[model samples]
Target: MSGYLTTHILDTARGLPAEGINIALFKIENGERQKIAETVTNSDGRTNAPILPAEAFEVGQYELVFFCGEYLENHGLTGGNLKFLDDIPIRFGMDDPAAHYHVPLLLSPYGYSTYRGS
Candidate 1:
């Protein structure tokens, strides 16, 4: 079995899936960021497909940039010019090539949390 990367966002404040949020996946190499994939969250707060599919998966450092600011603004949760939680970047490493990588974000207007999920 080959590993792939998947993610989702839950609005902690509203207790619902965050929809229409933009997410960008980047593979980091030698301190440089290379964008690999980009997608928007559906009604279920998940992408239709894995951001990093098995065939393209590799063991390395990666980052997921979640455009939380735009989502918050759309939902009327913005804080004027500077929002506390804007673009949330979760940087992690995938060490196993045959394991599923499920990174889920629990998000609120002022805070967020994430973990390796099943």
Candidate 2:
């Protein structure tokens, strides 16, 4: 099977799937970010399917914006005070678009971490 772009979110603070989190995928064009797709994490903390299908993969700079603050607030993981993170954006390039780009985010109310995955 061919590879594609995908992502998953893990709420480290809550120790569960970060369900219903909004995610947007974009590609940089002419020094500006252009929207490609937007999706919300399912109950399993993953998009319904890959963000970019194998056939649609192309070499370019891409970005993934994860709306963590709202997810945390709606899930009761945050208090009434203003949340620390609003929207977290991960920017990267598809050096080899043919290869799978698995970007996974491990998130908390105050911080988050992400890296290229297999």
Candidate 1 stretches greater than 4 Å from native = none
What does each candidate score in C-alpha RMSD? 0.9, 1.4
- How far residue 55's Cα lies from its native spot in candidate 2, in Å, is 2.1
Number of the predicted model whose TM-score against the real structure is largest: 1
Clashing pairs in 2: none
For candidate 1, write residues 50-95 as lDDT tens digits.
9999999999999999999988988877767778888999999999
Q: Give me candidate 1's TM-score against the actual structure.
A: 0.96
Q: Give candidate 1's error at residue 93 in angstroms.
A: 0.3
Instruction: Return the TM-score for each candidate structure.
Output: 0.96, 0.92
lDDT of 2 at 81: 88
Write down the lDDT of every candidate, Cα atoms only. Answer: 0.94, 0.88
What is the C-alpha local distance difference test score of candidate 2?
A: 0.88
